[model samples]
Target: MTEPKTRRTRNGARLPADQTTPRYLGENIEKDLREVSERTGGGTMQSRILVAAIALFAERGYENLNMRTLAGWVGLKAPTLYNYYASKEQLLVEAIELGMTDFFSYILDGIEDVPREDRLFEIVRRHAGYKMRHRLIARANDRLIDPQFARMFLPEDTARHFSGRMADYRHTVEELVRDYVADDALVSPKVATIALLSQCDRMAYWYDPGGSMTPEQALEQVTILIRRMLGIAA
Candidate 1:
């Protein structure tokens, strides 16, 4: 197979896209981060900068990450950085969208031929797993209350574009949950589903890979939590 292209974190350092560091915790995190950055642009310089920014924002509040400091982290002149991202807010919005897309893709990719009840559980696990794994990305997505993200990253037209694709996966799970509730396979499937999504959607704010939890361990815990939420007695 052809070698994959090299990618960089925000610091302009060269790192292989396939490589995953302990700092990032899992291969999927790096993969997802890079994929999202590539959606905006290519190369290690751009991707690494975006990854660094997310990691920083996760550590420090958004206000702490001004353009000068962010540019310094990426080893670029702050003004030149604007060529890539118009402003810090715009950059944040794009990153959030990329993060969401990365996560939704993972959850959608895992759905298979299992029964509807089991399918709902699987969806919960994968969605939770992704969030617990890529907490920074998830957190950045959650921090999208800024008007820029609402107006720019997720305009009605953009939301519709995302929905057109995301709808299939979302609808599949919703219907599965609805059916499970009807069949008594689950209690409060709708509530369970929403809660599960919330759990996955806010990983970035609280998940610290340096802390006591590993991504796999977090996934396991989240899976059990979601099962209990669904009254599945896991």
Candidate 2:
């Protein structure tokens, strides 16, 4: 029997000729893959590559997604793909960070202008809307930051950065919950914030754009549920 030749990139990175079986990132991979397959028509080459990378990572898991596979998705040679992202780790980090930043900004933008009484609802609406619109990205971001995966796959500094960002967002939500809770409400704001966010975030896993419920109806129902949970009157 002849030994199969191992392929190497210009920088001596090994390229796997065959796709490796996908590893489990978490329970969300199956749902993420479904959403990834439904997406199409990203704007520019670099943007399209990023979009494709997210989809591939969701479909193939971190170890199974190779440069050659990603490059093929973007219609570029493997070495040429390196010009955009030097390594799989670099690409994964960038994709995760970009998605987090965008998700945060989308939920926070114009929040300062919202009336005090309406601010919580506004933030909840945006959060739910973004998840419905970008479910695959949301799922990928969530999985990549899982403590087990983060500690094992991401550099310590990168993991810390994501943790800090997540903490900041949580604190922001806590403050909002504190302000919105009724004067005599018995709930702790921090606990309520966690519960509220968990409810909103889970939408990414189950929300169906094509289902009987429209995004508008879904957001309205979510906001109503949030209000009742917070003891706010309808």
Candidate 3:
């Protein structure tokens, strides 16, 4: 019999929605996928550690956030923290996967649901809003797994897995572009997708929900930008 395929929270081409217990929360899911080795001092320890990791990673960037520092932040000995993450690379990979999983499962799902012409605008707005809402996680994702910097953090296996997901995710964007172009809705599908991703990816760096605009307000502005780029009358 064929081996049962593991029910992954992430995958290439299409990621499955998280059906697991919502209690297990974090951007880095690989750490949580393994059997728990670190005993929780309290029920909230896991959640706290995850948040701490995100904050620290955002502050220091992946290159500087070593295991020892990470462990110290969580009040665990470096060796003892191995109970939670076998290695820093594995942990980084899992975190990257979590962000992408959310990206595809929810954000891309929204793109797929709407009609082709409106899809790109919806994608840009939602993508910007998501990065704003999950700022720290989004910043880490942008820096850590970028192709030029990927080798410093991800193991070979992790890189392969991540590359697969990224290609699949881009293909989804490409499909939308193609549909819009076929209908004369977009001037240049490839350029449009590239521009959209570039614009949306930067939202993490500057998003401030408490600043001059709320996320909804920002999303509306981004929607207008996308529509203008597509030459759609507002």
Task: Give candidate 2's whole-model lDDT.
Answer: 0.73
**Candidate 3 — which residues are off by over 4 angstroms?**
1-58, 61-63, 75-77, 109-118, 182-187
Error of 1 at 43 (Å): 5.6
Question: Regarding TM-score, does 1 or 3 come out ahead?
Answer: 3
Q: 2 or 3: which has the higher TM-score?
A: 2
lDDT of 1 at 67: 67
For 97-215, candidate 3 gives per-residue lDDT tens digits of 65566556557664556887777667776778767766655665566567766776667777888888887777777777675455455456767777777777778777675699878
True-vs-predicted CA distance for residue 187, candidate 3, Å: 5.4
Cα RMSD (angstroms) for every candidate in the order listed? 9.7, 7.1, 13.2
- For every model shown, what is its TM-score relative to the native structure? 0.59, 0.78, 0.67
Candidate ranking (TM-score, best to worst): 2, 3, 1
Q: What tens digits encode model 1's per-residue C-alpha lDDT throughout 24-107?
A: 322244555565566545646766677656654544445555566567655677899888888776676555555556667677
**Model 1, residue 88: C-alpha shift (Å):** 4.2
Location of the lowest summed lDDT over 10 successive residues in candidate 3: 15-24
